[model samples]
Target chain A: MIEANTPLLRMVRYFWPMVVLCIGLLIIVAAVDSTGDIILAQTLTEGLVRMVMVVALYMFIGNSGIISFGHIAFVLIGAYATAWQTCCPYTRDMFMPGLPTYLLNNSHHVVLAVFLAGLLAAFVALIAGFAIMRLSGIAASIGTFAFFMALYAAYGRWSTWTSGGSTVSPMEETTTPWSALAYAVVTIVAAFFYARSRWGLALRATRDDEIASKAAGVNVFGQRLLSFVITAFFCGMAGGLYAHFVAAITVDSFYLKMVFITLSMLVVGGMQSLTGAVVGVVVLSVVIDVLRRLEAGIGSFSLPTSSAEVGVGLIMLLILLFRPSGITGNAEIYWPFKGDISSSGAMKRQS
Target chain B: MDYAIQTIISALSLGSFYALGALGIGLLFSVLRLINFAHGDFITVGAYALIVPSSAVTATLLIGDFHPALLVLCIVGIVVMLAILSYFVVFQHAQKSSPATMMIISFALGYTLQNIIVMIYGGRPKAAGIWSDLTGQVQISSGVSVQLLQLVTIAVTWILLIALVLFLKRTRVGIQMRAAAEDFRMARMLGVNGKNVIALAFILSGGLAGIMSLLFVTQTGVLKFSMGVPIMLFFFIATVIGGMGSLVGSVVGGYSVGIVSVILSAILPEELRGFRDTCVFILVIIVLLARPQGLVLTKAAKERV
Candidate 1:
């Protein structure tokens, strides 16, 4: 009886895989860094940024059973927010003179700027989700997309702070592989905790059966909005990570391409679990990196430019066709030390 | 009044593209219960059929230089065939997937198709004018001066719209398609050939897209890989706002989008006009907030997994 699995232990069990995966990723990044593979390290760092982005995506999408294209908008806000805080005042003044007087005068520590960026993004998401969360199903999905388009259009043309359509470059590159991995790990932990939270349970219940959830007295809109804000915060932080990784930002970077890439990662990773989000980003990034290398000329074989996109799209289609739920089959990483799958299932069932 | 009439004339022409594209998308959505992002690429395919496939700077017309009737027929036939082929090749196997999965499949398929176009044609926008004379302006009435193509567009759209309505009301295959759209399982259990009806809807939509690409290319006078994307976006929005399941609603939604675009472009100051899409999308969000089922719905939108 003393050894029997408890809910608190089961929760910890659910949380461990992300920490393990992050450590594994950190080891890989360190090994690549030690080999002096600049390109490889940079690519892995970019992959880490995507990990944060996709996992952030999974928070709202996986738990709430809503597919959102708008989270990238939050990411865009974060990236720009990071840009404002970290840019050299002279360059920013010349390029983005529309920032507030304080933001114009001061440079923030990287950690504060990034977290504030997330907070800003989450605040914005709260407002957007308030307007959007009333609807259920497909309308909500399209509503999110509409929000994405609107934000993009506004940002693309609003030349005041963003420098409008031009790329803001050569500012800073504070997002190294180590930092990106840290962000990824943080996002995964945050998403895991949220998923295990009561709001996540209610949101997921609404996902499974909306009317039933309503009858069960769940505040469906509130739960969806809460998760939307939570994911938005993480995605915004990812934007900060991305901004510094490239040492640059553009409205286009956070456009349809990013939306598609991150959404595909979430969906391909199986959208139902934290592990799927991480796995999808890693798998897709590796595949993209390989294709890019091959396209750039790996000895005798060279593919056409943009072949990576086609290849990834084809691979996604094939994977989705074969396994509609995703590669993980919507399951988490099993507890390898013991046959804990049954016990975990039993605990969740009881909970 | 003259300025207003002039703007409306232009809006009517643009709206015609939305109407056709919306009809195509709406037809497919009804049958499949999912949006097909690749339908735009289907339009692109038909438009690209006008020229010899090449990576050259300027395009030389192939079937495009043929008699107008023959060219239209050829392109429509090609697109219809492509639509039917895509179903069998890609979507047929994906029928059991959720709406979200299916939408992603369509997005992936579109991405592949667009890249393939880039691979074949290169990314440069090539000048490909099928009918230069259509670009000429004509005096329509005492008040308004408009392009000849505008009049042609308005006339053709009304004709197509009426013809489509008649076909849906009177034809057996059309009725079967409608029945299947209403309730696929019930229709299948009854007498409708589900596969055939779905295929027919695809054909109708494909043919409509073909005609739209023609008009679109004629007006724009340039051919590019992503030529169909702008129209596809509007039509997709139209599918949602107008009503996913209702044909009339699709048309209404498409025209609404077109009119809004034109009006916004005209009204907004120069620096702010580029963000008209932002405004249009804001309206769409508001619309969804007010009416989650769309402005009109013959039936409730299908459940998403």
Candidate 2:
């Protein structure tokens, strides 16, 4: 084991190494689609945004040790929030015609718009969490799933507010490739920080033993609510970024399929570890990308493939049957290449 | 007044199916502490079984002339068998893991089964006939007509529920199942095979779902590919409101949801018709928060916090 003390040794733990790896991965992704062409850049941007979205989901599933099938609702909200801001007043007014004139005219500034969307998502979560976080285990899971279904029904029917599934367009003004990339990077960093924070530790403790945690004065309900709210914020942010990047939003994007995809990624990466989250996202993303390409290549030939649902279902089954605790199992990945130089002689001996 | 009677008949009929479905869910929860998310899918599976001609076996048993009851029993038998097989294969393995694992696996199984249904029979909805297309309407007064199927559904549901209660109370196996549900380890020590008991719970749940499907499709005259989610929600809400482990609670919960939905659909403004789901969810939330143990007798905790 590397000695705990020493200047150089301290600099190179699991945390910084993971950070470097993240940055390196980002650089590589940036290099692949750095060109300014709209279509190619858009695809690349979409992929990155998808990655961040999946990772944010991973953070929730990883840290909370509970299942959330309703998180996509927040994404839907964020997407609509951004869409409402970016689209021209006439278009927004045409879809959601009751908008006040001044409010419709003043919709600009993507940054503030996205932030507001996140806040709204969090607010919704706060209200929903009060109900959802009361139960534990499978009850909580079912409760959240029910909440999503209710919200889905409401969103579909609330035509006065969401314009009844009609595409609100011309959101192109709200997006810049650079901003999307920046958001993705910041989210990943934030996820990392949240994973190691005190709340994270308390959550793990709760997961490990709820009775003991309660005895230790940890309020299980409160912790779960806080975690859920944080997760909703990131999910909303991802949604806002996606809305701007895609130039539109639809209710379908936040359906059961999206929820399943996020759950599958969390399971594959190792539900218990941050490294597992990263790995799961990368692997699932690659699989999805390859499938898209293959489907495109096949063109007229329909492969009878049951969409992405099959992949997610298969992966979740395999992980549950094989690795119940997941790949990381509450441990962060430590690379040996980042040598322990703090003890001096040990580093020298290793070299 | 005619509309009121129609609505009441419709509500009671709908409640019958919901009661059957919720009982299935509640039984599994009580017996095994397993929330089979696939409970709704089992209902869908049963509907498909009734629809697909190739998978079905035709038999004519002449007691008087022909007994459709025997044929229905056969179909329910098939459903129970399939449910047993699925539980033995998927959930049995999850017995050693956390509750979350079982939930995920059940969900995965549900998804797979849904896709498989789509593959075998295309994603289009199928219409099932529990009763004949021939209609017998009770013309209560003038324009309002309550269909024969509505009455049949209510009768069948209550009969099945009575049978279930009798089976639970009167039979040795039923007693053992109940004992296992109360405390699996203690029941096991007393010589009840916990595994078999759990599997039995699943079989009973699936069989009930199949019966509900038959009644539901007969009433609606059409079944859709995506019918599982809404029905599942109905079952879940009923189970939650009535309490998970209590049979009487499941029945009460089903009636409560059916009555409330029917009332709301009628009295609710035209503009708020779409918000029926919102109301249902809000109601469930309020119920859960008020009585987390549910609206019945105190039982074991639903989930470990």
Candidate 3:
């Protein structure tokens, strides 16, 4: 256990494997795109999305031990913020009648706008955390869901500011194949730092037992709030990337369906481990895409055609029934850094 | 004066729907410690069953002129089928899981049921004759015309409430259910069949939801794929405000939510009407902060798990 938390242990964790995975995925993407196939490009896009989302899930639930139904709210806030800033000054001037004049004039520079979008999402989440983190257990879970509903209702009805639920599209700058790869790499690295941080340890202690942790002088509320804000930041970044990835966004894209899908990814990945989040998101997203393709073939074969949503739901149910603790439990796989160590020693050190 | 009476009458009719939904939810919560987010979908399934079969019967009558008695029997048959299906599939399965897991799974089941309905029938709203533009409203004064549907809704809900009270107090199974809900382990040690008692609770809750479905479809003359979600939220609020395990609490919670919503819409700006949900949540928070237990719980029942 002493060896596990050593600075040397931290330095090598994900250092080589992350680099290798990114390079491998990039080559695979490049090879497929070179074949002049649109499907290849689409697959690459899905790959990037899955990777980033998986990392975000790891940061939010895997590390923090808090289930959030409203993470999609940050996604919407970030997507719209970015789209509103990069779609062209004239287009913004015409459609968004009430946007600040400064924003209208600065509707270029996609990178800067996206950065701002992520920051804005983090700020909003910070505010929400103040009230919501006050709750614990089922009350906290219910409160967060209500937060999602409240935001959804507001986003739908307050259309004057958000073009009244119109799809914001044609952002001048878009995510290219290379940039998506870069974002994925950054996502994995950020997730590593987040999970190993002192704050992360505090959050985990709170999750295991609140009364004992409070007795140990941990600021339970502060740790939870900080984690919530950080998680929302990544979700916001993912939203920004998504906005630019497709050059279009809709309110419904960030609603309950997406929330459920995100949750399924996190759960299937293994709720307790970072590797599970990454594995679950990548595997499920690809599986879903493949199922969508099979829909047509299945229909021709006379089997009842099922939608992606149903397929995912079934997977979620099966996983729960069989492995309620999820695939990885709470263990993160850090290959090449597993110096000889006893498992019980690790457990004792954690306590 | 006429408009005032008409609005009050309409509100009261709508309040009955809220009351019915909340009452069932409250009953299940008292017994099972589960929220049954799928409860509203049960209502949706019941409405679809009643409306679809009744329409088929009405069309058959128009074509072959079937007996009116057969038509009535078919309607009853549809409602019974829906209630039984609700018990067998959702609530019964959910009883095995913990409260937290059940809440999540119930939500999953809800979306699954809703989407299956969409796949079969699409996302369009369906209505029945009771909610349709039937004529002949009784005018209490010059302009206060109350529709027959409104009267029927109120009368039926009141009768159901009375019968429910009598059944719970008088029946053997009902006594067993109350005993189990208070302390599951204790009741089991005393030889109560906990499984059978919980199953009965699901049946009663689902049946009450079925009755509400019939009334609501008639009153609004519309049913949409998404109506269940919002109504479910309001029902949850009602259950919480009324108290978790108290039958009377459910009734009071239902009426309170309905009346508060209507009054807020009337008094607040049109923009702020949406804030009523937020207000309800805030009210629950306040109740938790002050009492932790509900408004109407007994001393024995107040020590909630």
Candidate 4:
């Protein structure tokens, strides 16, 4: 191992570039909003929420080298938690008569609801991670997916709390462009710091070689569970933001389609780096937005709107075929005139 | 006794559908270590191949109007060709990637295929009455009646299962494919052609998907863009529960899931009936936790780590 630096300095050294990129992207969104483009602003806000969720995913998957199909379960939990706390008590009582008096009688500010959402999601993750993180490889993946299915089924049936499969609408639409940007920045910074922490290094070590890491005295399960819970927290926050952004919460929104889209973003950006997570979300979101506009016949040479969906899949496939590691391929964009830094190498030296 | 017999018949028929799907998934997983999320799309393609391409609410029979045997042949042929093409074009390029990456690629491929179908047929579900005779009830006992489709489904499943077993046991190509499934690199070094074995697996899997689609579409009588997803999801879960690389395990896993699903739905209370899926998944999680390697443990099921 290279010489050790203080944790604070090491975090700055490792994550300064990602921090700068997040701030820069937020500034660009803010600039676009100032030009009175409400649609663009709304889209950016949606993109920012996705950014938080994707980065949250990266926090666990990137460091631990595990692909989770069920992180969206946390998102579901978060969204519903927000809905439970923030929806009008009258509407909540009408739609969800099965809810307890505490939840049915109360409403909270968006910030507190969002926080509680994250906390609830984190608690669920704590329970699930204990069971799931014990198994490795594909079994673990399936286990998490099963967990997701159970949550989905429960949400769908336990109508008193989730409103079943119907849309839970008229949520407090509090997630503006600025708020989304703030959440994105916070998630990015948290992800960066978590990934650079000692547990993060330990988790990656275990991911590289579980047996070897165990032999080297690493508490692999503990590290994995910690990362899992932390990532779930941020994912839940994103879910809360999403519920407010769309003014609706539905179980369908947090199911297979969302899972695939976010996973694709992570893979396309570079599943191994924080920079990749942010970059992937921005690039794909912009591409999708442009395609949507084109599909709406914005251009003289317009294609059918359905083709836009096809375009996203094809582009992702081509990218995976050409660059399986993702657009950044484990590298981060450094300061002006300096070369890109390979995160793996930087991580090795830091650890 | 009559209710029990009916439940048994339903369970068996449903299990056949899942078993066929699981076999397809298991075959691919054995050779390529890929979950092949697009396998379900192959089923959808098979279903759609019977219908004329149109935007009408009701689809006209394309191959469905043909003689039964010819129709089966045509649907299977189209699905098999599409499967082989996909393997060549998409999977061949990512042959050496990690399982997670390959799975994502397959998902994208499925997404693309589903969208193409949407563009061609429009998003409205189309009704096609193919083999409506299969929908008739057959009374096996004085008081028990079952759908002819259920018996037919079971018969088809057993025939295919027996045929597959025989082929694997008796044929040189079957042995070679098994060898490849066991260890591709080792089999290649031992003079088995990797491409041929992998291609054969894909073809067989595609044929199974085709058969599954016919049975499913005949049962439901409606073809939607995402019709294959639920079956595929169950198949995926079954494949994992049975054991990733074991053929017999796949069949066993399929039946387990099917039986549990049928039983849960049958017994669930009115208000809690919606939670039948939750119960099924809870059972799956319990099974997984009990035996992480699956119900059948193969050498490949053991993780190196």
Task: Using lDDT, give the best candidate's number.
Answer: 4
> Which one wins on DockQ?
1
Kindly list the per-residue Cα lDDT of model 2 for residues A1-351, writing each as its tens digit.
454455655656535635764776677566655655665556556656666666677666666667777788888888787766766556677777655666567786878888888888989999999988987766677678778878877887878667776666667644554566677677777777776678876776777777999899888999889888987887887788888776766777678767777777777777766566666766777676665555455667644445455655777777788776665554455545545445333222110
Off by over 4 Å in 2: A1-9, A34-47, A173-181, A291-302, A338-351, B51-74, B126-136, B140-144, B302-305
Alpha-carbon shift of residue B263 in model 2 (angstroms): 1.3
Candidate 2 is graded, for docking, as acceptable
The stretch of ten residues in a row with the least summed lDDT in candidate 4 chain B is: B296-305
RMSD of 3: 4.5
lDDT tens per residue, model 2, B56-159:
23312122122568656755776787789888777777777766667677778778777666655566655454556424787767889888888888898988
Per-residue lDDT tens digits for candidate 1, residues B126-200, read: 888978899898887786778999889989999999999899989988888888888888899998888898788
Identify the leading candidate in terms of TM-score. 4
Task: Please say which candidate is ahead in TM-score: 2 or 3.
Answer: 2
User: What's the i-RMS of each model?
Assistant: 1.3, 2.1, 3.1, 1.5
Against the hidden reference, what TM-scores do the models get? 0.95, 0.88, 0.85, 0.96
lDDT of 4 by residue, B27-132 (tens): 9999999898999999999999998998778899989899999999999999999999998999989998888778889889998899889988998888887899
Q: What are the chain B TM-scores of all models?
A: 0.96, 0.88, 0.82, 0.98
| Pairs with backbone N, CA or C atoms under 3 Å apart (clashes), candidate 1 | none
Which residue runs does candidate 3 get wrong by more than 4 Å?
A1-36, A43-47, A50-54, A176-178, A302-306, A334-339, A343-351, B1-4, B51-98, B123-137, B220-223, B244-246, B271-305
**lDDT of each residue in A280-301, candidate 1, tens digit only:** 9989998999998988998888
